[model samples]
Target: MELRDIDLNLLVVFNELLHQGRVSAAARTLGMSQPAVSNALSRLRKLLGDDVFLNTSKGMVPTPLSERLAEPIAFALGTIHDTLNSKAEFDPATSARNFTVAMTDIGEISFLPALMKRLSEVAPGVTLSTVRNTAVNLREEMENARTDLAIGFLPDLQTGFFQRRLFSQRYVCLFRKGHPLAEQGITLKSFCAAEHVAIVAAGTGHGMVDESIQRAGITRKVRLQVPHFVAVGHILQTTDLIAVVPEAYAKRTLEPFDLETAVCPVKIPQIVINMLWHGRHHREPGNQWLRQTVFEEFSS
Candidate 1:
């Protein structure tokens, strides 16, 4: 393929078509007419020497070459978009931008208030929305720019994504402050024998904590399982069942409800929380501002 012969804009259209998976939908997304998109696709196919896409009942299925180029092209286009978008100077005081983030309920509990407070003081018009986190397809969601950022411990992350260590904290065993185990720190044997309130949801790594315990030849009987940390309090308050949770959230939300946490009796790895983004926005001015703001806010 001769670099001078290929229409560069057609590559952008190709990317959009691959992403949207339909010519008409891609046209709508790019704000171009369907014929125009089709024309761009034809040009792109001719230049690349591939069918690129096959129209099927399911939708546009990309050829192997198109599938292979999808990620790199998307990343490259995203970088160009961020670069061009930032050519206009940012005035945070007057600029109103909506940033949608994906975070766990506990992250919202720990960081949203401070983040909003800072935004109100510095950039009042800026808005924020936090989406629920799920186990499956999160990487794909981020890659497609559906979620601007994700905050948590994502294990085995892929290349072409950026991650920054936000903070790390040990897991704490939470129970009512005056509960029996709270008086004396739980022993490994006692902890393994006690009833637990586990958090179970689709696509969570926390399930591994249970697996690790079993691998150690110890078993902690789980009496109840809850989806979110906030719900753990309600269950802990009424029963002797203990819940293992992140120390930061435990310190913030559980204490008021007469809950207290102690170092876990068994050896568990410290949880390292990180903020993640697609490399496309690494140098974006506004994204840099937001990232630094979050880092400063959380570090304090």
Candidate 2:
């Protein structure tokens, strides 16, 4: 392929199409008409001398050639985007930039309110949109810029991602204020006998608490399994189910309801919370400012 034959704009369209996987969706993302995007794809195919993409029942599937080109094209685009952005100063107070954050529900409860209040005072024009973080796809999402940052207990991020430890939290058991377990402090025997509610954030019934219990050679009865920490309050308040959650989350829920928290009977390891971003955004001024803001606010 001749350098003169390549239109850089066509590569941008190709990258968007690769990410979106559908012509209409790519058009919306690129702010181009469907025909324009299709035309660009045609031009790219002709220039590259391969049918770069194929329309399938599932979506637009990239051919082997397209798959090979994806990384280099994306890297080049990212470099260009970051270079162009680096030239401009990022004044958060005046800039109307939207950032997408990926976090778990627990993270939302722990950080969103304080972060928003600080943002309102310091960066009135800035906006934040949050998406749930699933460790499975976090690396892909960040690399593609689908999420600017992910805040949670993500210990499995790949080598290419940059992560800053935000905080460390230990498990605390929460129960109704008047529950029998609350009267006398939690003990291994009582904790083992009580019916518990387990938070299965990773869709696995067993978590750190379970591991700790097993290590102590104690078998605790899990009467219920919940997907989120936010539901712990209502479940504990109305039912006799006790839940072991992060200390920060336990404290947050206790004030609103007649709930009490105590140290977990079984010793679970502290969870390390981190703010993760792709290396692609590591040097971008806007991302740097945001990362610094988060580090200053939450790193404890």
Q: What is the C-alpha lDDT of each candidate?
A: 0.81, 0.87
Model 2 C-alpha lDDT per residue in residues 1-300, reported as the tens digit of each score: 677868999999999999999999999998999999999999888888899999899999999999999999999999999998877579998989999998888889999999999999999999999987764476788889888998887767769888889888888899998899888888888998899998888732226777787888988799998777777898999887898888888888887888999988788888888888999999888999999999999999
lDDT of 1 by residue, 138-214 (tens): 67777777777877777756598888889987777888867888876788877877799988754554666676677
Q: What is the lDDT of residue 289 in candidate 1?
A: 76
Per-prediction tally of clashes? 0, 0
Cα displacement (Å) at residue 219, model 2: 1.6
RMSD of each: 15.5, 15.9
**Model 2's lDDT to the true fold?**
0.87
CA error at residue 113 for candidate 2, angstroms: 0.6
Best by lDDT: 2
